[model samples]
Target: MYRYDEFDATLVAERVAQFRGQVNRRLSGELTEDQFKPLRLMNGVYLQLHAYMLRVAIPYGTLTSQKMRKLAHIARKYDKGYGHLTTRQNIQFNWPALVDVPDILDELAEVEMHAIQTSGNCIRNTTSDQYAGATAEEVEDPRPYAEMIRQWSTFHPEFSYLPRKFKIAVTAADRDRAAVKFHDIGLRIHKNDAGEVGFEVYVGGGLGRTPFVGPTIREFLPKEYLLSYLEAILRVYNQQGRRDNKFKARIKILVNSEGVDGFANLVETEWNQIKNSGVDLPREEIDRIHAYFASPKFENLSGESKTHKAKIAEDKEFARWARTNLAEHKTSGYSIVNISVKPIGGIPGDISDIQMEAVADIAERFSFDEMCVTHEQNLVLPHVKKDDLFAVWSALKAVDLATANIGLVSDIIACPGLDYCSLANTRSIPIAQRIAERFSDFQKQEDLGELKIKISGCINACGHHHAGHIGILGVDKKGEEFYQITLGGSGAEDAAIGEIAGRGFSSDQVVDAVEKLVDYYKNNRQDKERFLDTYRRLGAQPFKEALYDAA
Candidate 1:
């Protein structure tokens, strides 16, 4: 994790002071709702369907024990007893009073965290692969570049207000876990034949009313010109991106309108002037930022853990968990343990204050006092010893956190839908709860094998429904909640968008619809094909027939 420097601390403190005055003015009635809308939004405060919601940034989804404890404190003091981890890997408190927002910001500043640029059409939080620093397959840690971009885009005077919200993701690994292709700007970091680091930049990818898989604008942008290249792309979009209709204002639409060739030409023309400007990254500066993410110390241990094998042999439940929850770490004896937050029938990403504290304790005890938040919305202790599996699982089970459903049918990615979100047309949490309850049988879930079920309240794809093997989108039809299902989508090395199966189902029928789809895949799939492979080979037509057979 990148520790806040003096400049970072000073800027956040100043923003807190500035927002305090803004909150005071709004409450004093000096600023009406109309007048306060933009101000509050800029500060990441929203007057949602109910009370105000505050989204606090968890930059690149990395958290310290201190920071996680601070979040627990904020949850207990400000709104509710829980905080919802969002699709972007940030956390949101759904029920905060507007008057106490400045105080919340003050509390956040205590931990060197804030809500700046988290909302209001500005460049949002820069997201990277949640497993950035720990994954065994990574070429390098991508967080330093993410941190640099975060600072540069925080309040870039030029892009503070744009046609629509802009998102950027960087991944240094060969596999794309950050959903980079679905971002406004996606940077794939690589080293050229000359052993020089650079990025392959993709632009105009986004998911909203208009979803697009971004196109490559620059095949290889040198490391020094990364920021400048980004500036050029945004500069082109900010000036010429549509503003007439909010629906068509995204950079995706702009790129589509101009065609990839025309857009590339525009960016090239703009980049030529700014490539070697003040923003050009120096080698020393990149190395300095990279220093913060250096790997933790590890003991020299053998390839396999005899203790771990013994534990797995002793406990079947532990074996199941170990199989699903543990990921390979770069080090020989260390493992990346994903402490499942999705207990059966529990909210997908809601971690209570006690759980938060427990996680902090575990991070300090088991990990090197570090944790990472997964894109699937799970907490990760990145450097757990292979020998500590049982101890970690035992501690996690005590807190009701050990649910062996990682990558299984019950391991769903869901948003805090209509229940908390004003923008939602229907409830997503209850739907997710229903699905979990339906697949209550762990044996059945394990038999069904690796299946991803993602739910979203709206078409914004916050739940990443577009990338799920089984995608569920909730819509409201004449005051009744309905859900639409899509299959075959994936967010992995072989990424592909999901295709809708058929007509939408009522809330009650949605779970049954999902169950039917799984059954069909089970009966039709080849020997070891996952649900995605089955759907791809069979296509939506077969699934569509099966889904709407009796309709």
Candidate 2:
């Protein structure tokens, strides 16, 4: 993790003082609700349906034990005793008092964290793969690039107020764990034929009222010109993107209207003028950022852990968790452990204050004093020793944090929905809870295999409903909530927006509908095919028929 320099510390402290004054002005009636809207949004404070919400940015989803403990402290001191992890790998406090927000910001600054750019129409937090440097398959660690962008975009006067909020994601792994394709700008780091590293840049991919997979504007951009190229793209969007209608303001809408070729031409023309400008990252600067993300020291253990193998054979519960929640590490003696926040029948991504502190303790003790927040609403102890797996699992179990459903059906991604969000039409948490409860059997979930269920309370797609293998969207009809189902959507390397099955289901009927679709796939799938694979082979017709025809 990167420590804040003097300049960074000064900037954040000044911003907090500024926001504190602004908050006081609003409370004193010097600024009305409309007047305070932009100021509060710039600081990541939102007036939700029930109370004020504060969204704290977890840059590229990486955090140290110190920062994690601060989050636990914030959750305990202010708000309720828990915080909700967002699909963008941020955390949200849904019940903060309006007057307490400035104090919260001050506390966050002490830990080198802030809530800036989390809610405004400016550039939001740049996210990346949770297993960035530790995973075995990455072409290069992408966090340094993400950090560079974060520095460039933070309070950049040119892009402070765009037509709509912009999101950027980067991934270096073959598997797109960051869901880069669904971002406003997605960057894939890879090596070229000549073995030089570069980026595959995708623009205009987003999901809201309109869903799109952003087209690649450049097949390969030299690593040196990364910042310059990004500047060019943002310049093009800032000058020409829609401003008349809020609904049509996103860059995705602009990309759709101008076509990929036209947009690419504009960006390339802008890039040609600025490609060699001073904004182009110098080699030393890049190296400096890269140094912050260099791998931690690992003992030279030449083989797999004998104790780990024995433990798996001895304890069925630990064995089940290991099989589902662990990923291979580049280091032979270490494993990447994913801690599921989505316990069976619990609100997806909700971690209590005690759980946060417990995980932070475990991270310090077992995972090199670091933790990561996954886009799928889970936590990762990226470098756990294989020999200490049982100890870590036992610690997590004591805190009620050890649930083995990482990618299974019960590992749902859901938004706050009507419970807190003013823009939501229905409740998303209950739907996720019902579905998880219906499929609580761990054996059954594993047997069904790799089913991703995402739910959004509205069409905004905050839960990334468009990217799930089985997506559920909540819609309002005649003042009543109804759930709509989509099948075959995926947020992987081969990304696809799910297609709608048919008519919507009542709240009472949605869970059973999901069950039917799962049963249909289980009965029809070819040998060991996942839900997504089977859906692709059989198409949506069978699943649609299974959901609607049987209803």
Candidate 3:
């Protein structure tokens, strides 16, 4: 993790003092609710259905063990005894007193984290694969670049008030775990034939009322001009991106209105003038940032872990957890352990204070004091030694965090729909719970194979329903809850939007409809093909037939 420099520290400290004053004013009536709206939003405070909700940024989904403890502290003191990890790789406190927000910001400042740019139409947190540095396939760590972007975009005067919120994602591996295709700006770090590292920049990608997979603006953007080229794209968006209607405000809408070629041309023309500017990355500066992300001190050890195998064989429950929760780490004798938040019949991403403390303790004791928040809304102990698997699992199980459903159907990604979000059309959490409960059997889930069942409460697609093997999108028809299903969608290297399977299903019919679809896939699938592969082979026709067979 990149520690805050003097400049970074000064800026955040100042912002806290500034917001403190603003909050006092609002409470004292010096500023009316209308007057304090933008100021509060800039600080990540939201006036939700019940009380105020504060969203704190976890930049690029990276957090130190200490930072995690601080967040848990904040949750314990200021808000409720729990926090909801959002789909955008941010942690949100659902209940916070409006007056205590400034205090919360101060606490976050101490950890080099903040709520700035978390809300508002400005550039939001730049996200990446939660397993970035640890992923075996990655060419290099992507966090240094993500941190660089965070510094540049923080309170950027030129883009403080864009037409809508801007999101950027970066991925270094061939697998697109960061959902680069669905971001306002997506960068895939790659090396060309010359072996010089650079980016494959994609622009005009986003999901909302309209969804668009970004187009490549530059097939290969040189490493030197990363910031300069990014500035060019933002400049174009600031100048010409839609502002007349909130519905048509995202960069994706602009790209859709003006073809991808036209948008790319505009970005290129702007970039040509700023190619050799001072904004270009200097080698020394790059090295300075990269130093923070150097590989952890790893001991040379054999791939085989007799201790781990022994434990797995000794305990049946531990064996079950080992099957789905553990992942291959870059270093030998270590594994990336996913702590699934989506226990059957439990809320998808809500973690209580006890669970938080348990996770923090495990990370400190067994994982060398580092943890990560995954985009799938799960917690990760990024570097757990294989020898510590059983002990960690026991600790996690004590806190009810030992669900062995990492990528299984029971592991669902659902947005805080009508239950919490003001933008949601129908309740998503309950629907997710129902789905998880529907597949309560662990062996049945494993037999079903890897399947991503994502549900978004609305068209904004916060849950990334469009990218799921089986996507369920909630809609409202005459004030009644309805869902639209899409199949064959993926957010990987071969990214594509899911086609709607058929007509919408009412809330009452949704679970059965999903069951029908899954059953159809299972019956028709050849060999051990996954849900996605089966969808690809047979297309949506068979699923549709099964879903609406009586109709």
- Tell me, what's the RMSD of every candidate? 1.3, 0.7, 1.3
Clashing pairs in 3: none
List ranges where model 3 is wrong by over 4 Å: none
What's the CA error at residue 158 for candidate 1, in Å?
0.6
- Compared with the true structure, what per-residue lDDT tens digits does model 2 show for residues 426-472? 99999999999999999998888899999999999998899989999
Q: Give the Å shift of residue 346 in candidate 3.
A: 0.9
* lDDT tens digits by residue: candidate 3, 1-551: 89999999999999999999998999898999889889888889888777889999999988776788888899899877999998778999999998888888988998889999899899999999878878788888899999889988999999999988899999999988788988999999999999988999998887666778898878898877889999999999999988999898888888877788999898899889887778777899888999998878888878888998998888888998899888888997889899999889999999987788888888888877778888899988888888888889989999899998888999999998998888889989999999899999998998898899999999989899998888999999999999999988887787888889888999889999999988988898899999999988887788788889984
TM-score of each: 0.98, 0.99, 0.97
Higher-ranked by TM-score: 1 or 2: 2
Give per-residue lDDT, candidate 3, residue 71: 87
Give the worst 10-residue stretch by lDDT in candidate 2: 541-550
TM-score of predicted structure 1: 0.98
Error of 2 at 327 (Å): 0.1
Better of 2 and 3 by TM-score: 2
Residue 467 error, candidate 3, Å? 1.5
